[model samples]
Target: MDENTAFPGASDESKAEYILSNVAEVVERILTFVPTKSLLKMTCVCKLWRNCARRVLRVQQNMTWVSASGPSNCDGHALCPKLADEVENIYILPKTVLVMVDSETFNGQDCCYKQKKARKSHHGPDSIEELNGLFPKGCDIMGVATPGIVLTPTGSHSGAPKEFQEGEAGYAIMFPRMEGVDIRPFHFCKNTISEANLVEAGLVNNTDLRVVLLFGYDAFKPGAARFLNQVLEPLARSKVLIAGGHVENVFSPKRKCCDRGSYGVVGLTLSGPKIQGASVLLEQDVSSAKAAEAIIQRLKAANLPERNTLGFMFACVGRGHNYYNNQRNVEADTFRKVFPNIPLFGFFGNGEIGCDRIVKEDYNLCDMDSDGLQHGYTTVMTLVHLG
Candidate 1:
């Protein structure tokens, strides 16, 4: 065929360019839907495909990262201005005392002298309001004190006061707007109680399960008995025995006695859309790979979005290295293997706050307290898809 006939009014180079452009466009579109792990693999296909994949991964605009800094001498007051300007709400995971002072009081210019006593309740409105007042007007706040360290943009801190030790105490804020995606809280039981038994115990109804909180201490004989009764009664009533599975026990050296049971453990179950129901993976005597596989299976079963752009992992402090055979970050690595390229941030917490399921009976109650159930010895993953 003649040159014009073969090329259709285009040179050989131009024809090749036109075909490659179309291929790149198609590849970019496909990459958007592909999991981050697979997308990374696709980068080896060609330079054009690699470039397209990188561009798509980098331009994720659904999540915003905002941060600010203050003098090292400042306490929690230093965080107020920076937080007020950027964060609408705050979740405090404090390892030490976290005091919130009014901006004017902090500046020392005007002492309105509102010496309010710091509330002793956890996750209470009075405490939340005090934290909010530290910031400018119109800023809302909520937080839970964690026994473990807090991770911020600058660096991880124990949240201890500088007077006690030399370290910067401040806040790191990440704003994940809950406009489109479904945010479901999950709790996984380490026990091997059968689903049938769980149903009989009134813990689970068909697929729905209730979150149970267990409190115990070694010093209190009756308290331990009561705790055991609380757990065993349901099983006893149903005549079900925990045949096999890991039972998680969190021990605190700081806890010497139990006036009313100093130790506590919370249980949660999956709830929400049928497809979005929580996945309760039993991790007792299971390898990290196995646990991760189970989690991936549940995610796939729930039909989670193929493109999970952002993730927040609330893992128990005892889990990461200890549970994963001394391998550091095996849990996170396992999650990355399943949902690659997603931006994940979270700290190992002594107790995690996430919902076990959606509260339908008390719709208003759910709205009022959306904070999920508190959990221990579990890793809760809150994945977000901005499709």
Candidate 2:
């Protein structure tokens, strides 16, 4: 028999231990260049390899989006084929609620006819009128952030719950600083009626929140923003810069007021110690590999307090694998580098949510959907430092 093949009666536990020992060495040797997909396949080569892979995949600490949709077809497709066959706790968004609008809907001339007509029919001026009137007069009138309508010059659309303005030229999508929506599913009550409430509640019991990362499935409802802003305002005031997701122009006014806000769909806030002497990498500035390297160097460079652990979460858009094979793949690559031993989990989303504050050129509140809008090509990832 070959030296590689094991005897027929070898136990799974023994095989796993053997594989884990070798895998650990491999991780130590090629930790920098190892690809997660390749790592998964290597596990299938033997019973021992399978065991080591499971241990590596098991999440010890994690941050996940509150709401997300699973792959449209996970049984056969490869959205996350490596982990596809092994993951059991995957969270998927309900199929009925998310909808996709063609680019024509936003650019065609007749696209907003129905919306404009509805406004004319209203006797006391429609909600859109009321919201638009709120904007500073002669302000070039970009977009509106409201609860039921998101009107842009290109097109005016109505969902149901709320809307956030998409700034001028539609160059950016922004989440305005406003109160959370009054939707039932997201209603905030003392009994923990909403996801935010649950997060807040969880925070109370565990006081180890040094670096907090908030992953949004979509923009913050006006009400939700109010709560988050108020809660996090203190942190920002204390020099804890809130970042992630893209809303540069909207946040320009307050740029000097905090750390930085230049990412596109996710917000990452590291503690002061975590940021000490560590170089910064805006999401747009680097690929997953470099991002991972930045994270590892930062963590290793800083001498964090006891019990500190890094956590990450991401809200993926329904977009296809065009950007770079797949958004999740990019995410996984970063994970392998920064916190190889840490736990991680998340799901694809309809809309990404980030910080509660609104930037100048970000999407207005008008575009938010009652059921939440789904953009095909967007992703939001969050990383938290847990102690």
Candidate 3:
């Protein structure tokens, strides 16, 4: 049909614009009806439609849950063909692909992102060549990246910190999609961390940093210990929900999940209007049963305003099934009882970068004056509330 018949008094270009604008208008109305968690996964469609509507069709929502699948054997696709297929880029949103296998299987090099088969994305950049101008100035990235809706128009720089070298056995391909919707990255290198560095990284001396995801690598316990003394000691009074592990080399006869990276120490500071967090630290000096009792008491006594949507537990490798007298998921199972049905994920390592501060419901007051220290032989848990 001619443009004159459909859109009278409009030129060809104008008619095209009118049709696109109407399409965007319909999508905008649909967005308001979508659940908050699902709404976050829905992007602006593309840069073209994004510009056409500009502000009208933009949607704002928080990420409550992220689908995590696999232990897939990518080499053969024989072990987990279904899991391998799960990660196929059907959603169009970027996903953080974490692959941890032995050096024999995956050489800790280029194969980390081998599974992310590039197919034509209808709404995203048509080609890798077109990703040039989307990221703003000073937002340079070291490795490859895809521009996706990471809760902002700005770029979520993908790659390891410059300090990390030849990290092997395991690698994490952090696509734009992460557990965090609103977040910032920070690094601590060569045992050098101060107020200045913290400020520059948006870790400390800022109102924005509320929750943090940290990873510390050391054979001994000094790295995590020093972090707590130097970093958390100063901000001992400040309420920061810290969650992460002090990564140690684990050699198990029955290997579960493994990651090997020379990643010294890294963190992601989380903050946004939609993010609310709570945390707890449980010591394991006593018997497993007693420790579980303590965790129950502390968590139950504490009050939280919003329901916990997700959880992260950074626990000691020593405190698992063997420690719990052949009982699997004792710690995790304990957590589930308190905040039932809340999605939780974490790892077992030598040390943890974690703590908890339960606030009063009406007063919104912190209950304990405990310093959030992460050392070996303790369990640190962080529960997330997404508004």
Please write out the lDDT profile of model 1 over residues 89-174, one tens digit for every residue: 32221111212222211222111111123232122233233344543332222222222222223222212111101122233333
Q: State TM-scores per candidate.
A: 0.36, 0.29, 0.58
TM-score: the better of candidates 1 and 2? 1
lDDT of 3 by residue, 5-57 (tens): 77878788987666655676665665555532344444455654444332322
lDDT, candidate 2, at 343: 36
RMSD (Å) of each candidate, 1 decimal: 16.3, 19.0, 11.6
Q: Write the number of the candidate with greater TM-score, choosing between 1 and 3.
A: 3
What residue pairs are clashing in model 1?
354-372, 354-373, 355-372
Cα-based lDDT for every prediction: 0.37, 0.28, 0.44
lDDT of 1: 0.37
Error of 1 at 271 (Å): 11
When summed lDDT is taken over every stretch of 10 residues in candidate 3, the lowest stretch is: 146-155
Please give the lDDT score at residue 173 for candidate 1.
Answer: 36
Q: Tell me how many clashing residue pairs each candidate has.
A: 3, 57, 3
